[model samples]
Target: MTLEELFYLHNQTIFKYLYYLLNDEKLAEDFTQETFTRFLHYEKSIKAGAELAWLRRTARNLAYDHYRRKRLIQFVPFLQGHEEQEPISPHQWLLQQEEAKALYLAIRQLKLSYRDVIILRKIEGLSIQETCDVLGWNEGKVKNTLKRALAVLQKQLGGDWDD
Candidate 1:
């Protein structure tokens, strides 16, 4: 497919995935753009019919890199002030619904593996095989991780959590 077609088909999904992973809308937008930019550089190397998976993996890596940089910045007093916090947007306010906010916060508190599995399987509605492809995990690992992630989420959310 052409670049425009590919973007049209997968951009929102990629953006939302990044947003969920990063919990920063502006950063998510930046990473989503970077993900597509990298795709442009490596498009010829990517296999056909696997574009979504490739995009997801790329986005995931970018989020992880961002987390690493942020963690490192925390230790360097000089670099800390260089990062500016953006004002929260109206969309962010809309996310303040009690249950939704609680769930989002709970997910953010999870370890990376658990958070990723929950986002891909439950939030993004990716199938087990698709999630495995994006995460580079075997089927068994994906299933086990997803089960554990759900259990943690349920516990974190308490009585409000429904199966």
Candidate 2:
């Protein structure tokens, strides 16, 4: 397919794909724009049938660049003013939230290779080959990292994992 046709057809799907990776709607939109812009040049580099893979790789690199820029800028996510207020009895309402936060913390503490596998497999619901493609990991490495990540999470959370 021509690059224009690909962009026209796959833009939203691509945006959603990047959205999950970036976890920021606006940032994902920007990366989608960046991806398409880069696609114009990178399209010729692809060997016809490989355009989709090229787009994914280019978008992944762009997402990393966006995150690197965010890190350098010390960016904090913006929030609505009213949502910033603390609850009078946060313990009562925030039990689930606390658990989720704990889970996120545990995930964050993992090494990046392990973390990527877990996010792709568990959170993003990608299959083994998809996760392998997204992270450019071989099958064995992806399986090993996923195993290690789950073990880490299990050990860290202890019995809470069952809940």
- lDDT values for all models: 0.80, 0.69
Estimate TM-scores for all models. 0.79, 0.68
Q: Tens digit of lDDT per residue, candidate 1, span 1-163?
A: 9989999999988987886666677988999999999999999999999899999999999988887977831110011222466766777646644556677677767788987787788777899999999999999999999888888888888854553
- Which regions of candidate 1 fall more than 4 Å away from where they truly are? 72-96, 160-163
For model 2, state the Cα shift of residue 158 in Å. 2.5
Instruction: Tell me the spans in candidate 2 whose CA falls farther than 4 Å from its real position.
Output: 47-50, 70-98, 160-163
lDDT of 2 by residue, 29-112 (tens): 888888888888766666765555566667767876777777732112112223555655757557756666677777766765
Worst 10 residues of 2 by lDDT: 73-82
